[model samples]
Target: MSRIGKKPVDVPSGVTATVNGQDVNVKGPKGELAFRVHDEVVVEFKDGKVSVQPRTESKGARSKWGMSRTMVSNLVEGVTKGFEKKLEISGVGYRAAVQGKELVLALGYSHDVKYPIPEGIEIKCAKPTEILISGIDKQRVGQVAAEIREFRGPEPYKGKGVKYANEFIFRKEGKKK
Candidate 1:
């Protein structure tokens, strides 16, 4: 039995949830989102809560049970509170700015790196060294943040580059003189 699958996802007030076959859709104050669960699991909504169950006792079904349940719950949470990822620039002269719908980054390169913002995702530069990515889709927000960080990953020597705000960089000892 899957522990997480046993718990139902409660639909909070002012939020709407619907289950159609293997598809689950949630609409909340933040926005709307949907997810398609695997056929190995069954989805149902009753008494203001959504539940997931394995179709059979097979191992494949059991393996998807918990994952399907969590995906449904994430849809509810994502549509309500949304998701956010923050990145910090640590290198000298490295900074970020939003130009219209694009993110202009200066990572010590000869030319500035321009990243076009995708739909449904919002990118904001609270400070020259801070980048905030927010969206209802958790995957999209994370992907965008990863793409931005990929431009200049943190180096182990000086630990200089772009990284998650809460991330810890492992520093390496400098070369011998």
Candidate 2:
């Protein structure tokens, strides 16, 4: 009964998808990714499209059906187009840089913070205050971005810190004179 689960995910040209048991694997120009469908859901590749359906009419099965389908869709899209996250640092001395496999950050800390980049993920610093994170796995890309932002989340008073490119920070008025 899930509308999203009813629509099968399309397998675009030049991208290949395979369903083996509960495992769904997809490979495309960008990269390859795999996902294990929940046991309550059934996944199948048919006619150049991947389909997901609930294994039973149980409430739990239905609840996971749509989510499983979306997960599969994300895998296909990830391998084909990949995913990216952009972070911007704002402050007098806040900056970021990538050297070798590590990201060096200066968030007004007493010492520079060094974060080791994970495999299969790429980090780039076009500008000292801009950080670009890209990878085939959507979850990992987001996790990295979040971790970086966690180092110095924007403060309401000064609105200075690392934050997402499109994020809006709520400003707080200073003490009245």
Candidate 3:
């Protein structure tokens, strides 16, 4: 038996979780999220806690049993508290601004890079060099943050580029003359 799979997921107030066949729908104040659970995993709600049970002892079932439960638990937490990602601009003259529904990034490129903001995600600029991305879905929030960071990864020499707030870029010394 998987320890994580045997654990119960607590459902907070104002969040409704419904299991429909293989799909789990979670609705909360922030938004609604749906997940397609693995075939071998079965979820049940009892005494205000959700539990995941595997149908068999096969490798595939064991592998996905805990994962499925964690995914569902994350979904519930996301809708309740949401998710957030922070980015920092390092290069000089590098800045980001919101224009309508798009994010305009001037990262030393000839032309500005315009990124369309997806629905259910919110972007905020705190200070000229800091950016905050928040959403209910963890995958979507991470994808947006990665796409933004990919615009200009941290350079080795100056470490000037877009990077996560907590990310560290190792610096190397130049060759001896």
Candidate 4:
């Protein structure tokens, strides 16, 4: 049995959740979000909570059980508390700025990299080296952060580039003289 799948997702006060067939929708003070669960799992709402269960005792159903439950929980959390990701730019002359609707990044390149911000997502530059990304959808927030980090991943030698705020870069030793 899946431990995560067995636990029901509690719908906190001021947040509303609904299950329509394979779709789960959640609305809260912050915003609203929805998710479509796999056919191998069944979703239900009751007692101010949402639950997910496998439709059959099969490998596919078992694999999707916990995933479906987490998706429902994420929908509720996203609509209520939302999600956030922080990126740190580290390199000589490297920095970031929010220019209107685009994120302008200078990662030691000749030209500034401009990234157009997407709808429902917010990007802010607290400092020249700090990028804060927030959104109601967890997946979208993470995706945008990943895309920015991919532009200049941290190098093992100098450990310079865009990296997650909490991430650690395993530095490598320089060649011996």
Candidate 5:
């Protein structure tokens, strides 16, 4: 039995959860999110909580039970509290700015890199070198942060480039003269 799958996901006050067939939808102050569970798992919303159980005594069904529960939990939390990611730009000329709906980046490149911001996600430049990404969907926030960091990933030599605020970069020694 999956330990996490056994615990029920509580639906807080002011938040609503509805389960229709294999589809589960959660609505909260932040936003509304929906998830479709696999046929092997049964989802229930009762007594202000959501629960997931396996439909059969099979390995695949058991495996899907825990994942389905987690997905439901994430949906509820996402629509309630939402998600956020922070990025830090390091380097002599590395900087970022929000120009209208575009994120203009200067990562020592000859031409400036312009990234178009997508819908439902908000990008803010707290400073020229600091960026904040926020959205109701956790996966989309993380994906946007990763794509921004990919523009100029941290280098080992000087530890310069864009990276997560809490990320640790291993340093490397330079060649001897």
Candidate 6:
């Protein structure tokens, strides 16, 4: 049996969950998220909690069972509390700004890179070097942040590029004299 799958997901007040066939939909104050449960997994919501059960005790069923349950749980949490990603800009002239529905980034490139903001996501720039990304969908928020970071990946030598606020890059030592 999967330990994670055995744990029941607590349903918070004001959040609603519905299961339709294999599809699971969760709605909360922030937004709504939907997921499809695996064929070998069965889910139930009762008494302010959700539970997942595998149809069989096989290895494949056990493995997928936990993942399906966790995905459902994450969907619930994401809709309730939303998701956030923070990015920091490095380099002398590299910076970022929000222009209407686009994110304008100057990452030491000859021309500025413009990224269109997707719907249901919000971008905030406290400073030119700091960026905040917020959205109800955890996957999309992370994807957008990763794309922005890929625009100018951190260099090993100077570490001048965009990176997650808490990310760390290892610096290489200089050659001996």
| Number of the top TM-score candidate | 4
What is candidate 4's lDDT per residue for 1-177, written digit by digit as tens?
999999999999999998999989899998989899999999999999998999999999999999999988888889888899999988999999999999999998889999999999999999999999999999999999999999999999998999999999999999999
Query: Any idea what lDDT model 4 has?
Result: 0.94
> TM-score: which is higher, 1 or 4?
4
Please provide, for model 6 over 74-167, each residue's C-alpha lDDT reduced to its tens digit, 9 standing for 90 to 100.
8888988988999999999999999999999999889999999999999999999999999988889999999999999998888899999999
Off by over 4 Å in 4: none
- TM-scores for all candidates: the values are 0.97, 0.97, 0.96, 0.98, 0.96, 0.95
lDDT of 1 at 83: 90
lDDT by candidate, in order shown: 0.93, 0.95, 0.91, 0.94, 0.94, 0.91
Candidate 3 structure quality by residue, lDDT tens digits, 47-141: 77778889899999999999999999999999899999999998889999988999999999999999999998999886768889999999999
TM-score winner, 1 or 5: 1
Give the lDDT of residue 84 in candidate 5. Answer: 93
Q: Relative to the unseen true structure, what is the Cα RMSD of model 3?
A: 1.1
Worst 10 residues of 3 by lDDT: 42-51
Name the lDDT value of residue 128 in candidate 1: 98
Query: In what order do the candidates fall by lDDT, top score first?
Result: 2, 4, 5, 1, 6, 3
- Per-residue C-alpha lDDT of model 1 across residues 1-177, encoded as one tens digit per residue: 999999999999999998998888899998889899999899999999999999999999999999988888888888888899999999889999999989999999999999999999999998999999999898899999999999999999998899999999988999898
160 Cα displacement, candidate 1 (Å): 0.9
Candidate 4 local lDDT, residue 153: 96
Q: RMSD in angstroms, candidate 6?
A: 1.2
